[model samples]
Target: MSDSVPMTPECYARLQEELKNRIKVDRPKVVQDIAEARSHGDLSENAEYDAAKDRQAHIEGRIAELNDKLARAEVIDPKSINTDKIVFGATVTLFDTDSDNEVVYQIVGEDEADIKQGKISVTSPVGKALIGHTLDDEVRINVPSGTRIYEVTEIEYK
Candidate 1:
């Protein structure tokens, strides 16, 4: 199954930068580390060699994954979004119906989610429930813990 996730232009640019860094700086360094480790001793008992090989594999896999995501990315500028309704890339401020606490979240792409920064992935349960909703709408989201209700209070693009 394939679903396209919209990413901001800034997120896309960051992905490109990461891909370039991994391919140009990280890949060669790992390969060289593996080569040097191999020169130290036999592979049967070489921890450094094994670790380097594992790191190399992980780096290559991430590079390929990033490339795939970049190829499929639909870049949208967050600043261009102008809707009172919640949508991808919108910063939503909500009043928790259950707790009566205000919360703000930026709906972002999967790779950009950081709860500490108040950015939630568009695919998250709460984010999904909030999408297409406008101010004064009550949103009920089913989370792993339980159901939570939030009232939409504000939406911003930045």
Candidate 2:
């Protein structure tokens, strides 16, 4: 069976854009570099040629990876989700009982996870605990710091 990775529509679009750039712009640039290095003479002592080849290999590997991910991507759109309980793509607001803090987080795909942007991966500890939870529900999570309790304050999809 083939493996499929879940991704938000925005993340899937970003991957497509990167793949297009790699094929259209970066690929040709690497080819031109290799050609230029080859014209510089003896291959036995051609450091430039060796470097170009290494770069070419790296670029090709990235292209292959991007293509594979795009081929197996499952795009989940936030706008189409309608659920009262927390699930993938749900933006949840929680009131931390520990430090008396309120924070917002959106459960997103692993590729789209960025703590600075308030997007957490579904497999993360906090995200996993929030799954299937509803507003006004209390959730307990164990972190490296310690165990803490949080009350689900809100849930929105956008």
Candidate 3:
């Protein structure tokens, strides 16, 4: 019944830092801007006031969203887990059976997924295929190009 989602320690810290900035810096700046705009005059016709209000709304909405995610986050430390099998937060190295190339990818939460950084979402097809698999396990996944096979070469918690 919990809506908690898995998050890395780094990811949690990043979220906390962003929330702190929004609350401590961005929020107060917007308030000051609104105050300055209000002083300029008419409530309905003030474009600066309206713009400030909209910015405040966006900042507040983002703050709330970040707070909610932080509250529901289940921080999973990679170092805390000791397993040869691939799981969430595990860095996996695989050898492409078809391309004869090797690739490394870290299984991360959806929010931290960046393919260019070698981080893949747990919900992704490759992540799903790699999960629960161990070294030497042959994995076959169907891609748009066709079926591709990979041989798990390594799994690291760090």
Candidate 4:
């Protein structure tokens, strides 16, 4: 067993879909490629065979990793969350006092975090600072560049 992975139901479903595709589609294609490459000529000089073998290894490794993550998944539904304070699956709007700009970020699991998409991992510095804070709370976070100050303006579960 491994440490439990906290993720939204959507993220869990996406992982399951990826696992299914790898096992049912990618695995067979790679196997066929390997067989075709083997029929070409000498193993030592066959670049296609080596490439196919490498692809097969990568696919297998990903399959195992996805299986482990799915097995240890702890799915959290955003719609069911009810809290005044910030927590997992919370879409938070922060007002940056220094830049005088507002930014929205959704606190999500590591696998689902995408800064460009306004999703931040719960373990991130900003996310850690925002946790347990209610609306209008001032949060100061330290990043790689420097320190930043933000005021919580809005909090939404969905």
The per-prediction CA RMSD against the true structure, in angstroms, equals: 1.5, 1.6, 1.8, 1.1
Ranking by TM-score: 4, 1, 2, 3
Task: Quote each prediction's TM-score.
Answer: 0.92, 0.91, 0.89, 0.96
lDDT of 3 by residue, 71-95 (tens): 9999999999998889999998999
Better of 1 and 3 by lDDT: 3
| Candidate scoring better on TM-score of 1 and 4 | 4
The residue pairs in collision within model 3 are: none
| Model 1 ranges with Cα > 4 A deviation | none
Candidate 4 local lDDT, 7-37, one digit each (tens): 9999999999999999999999999999999
lDDT of each: 0.91, 0.93, 0.94, 0.96
Q: Assess candidate 2 and give its lDDT.
A: 0.93
Give lDDT: candidate 1, residue 55. 99
Residue 101 lDDT in candidate 2 = 100
Off-target runs (Cα >4 Å) in candidate 3 are none
Per residue, candidate 2 scores C-alpha lDDT tens digits across 33-149 of 999999999988999999999999999999999999988998988878999999999999999998899999999988899999999999999989999999899999998998989
Alpha carbon RMSD to native, model 4: 1.1
What is the Å distance of residue 126 in model 3 from its true position?
2.2
Give residue 49's error in model 4 in angstroms. Answer: 0.7
TM-score of 2: 0.91
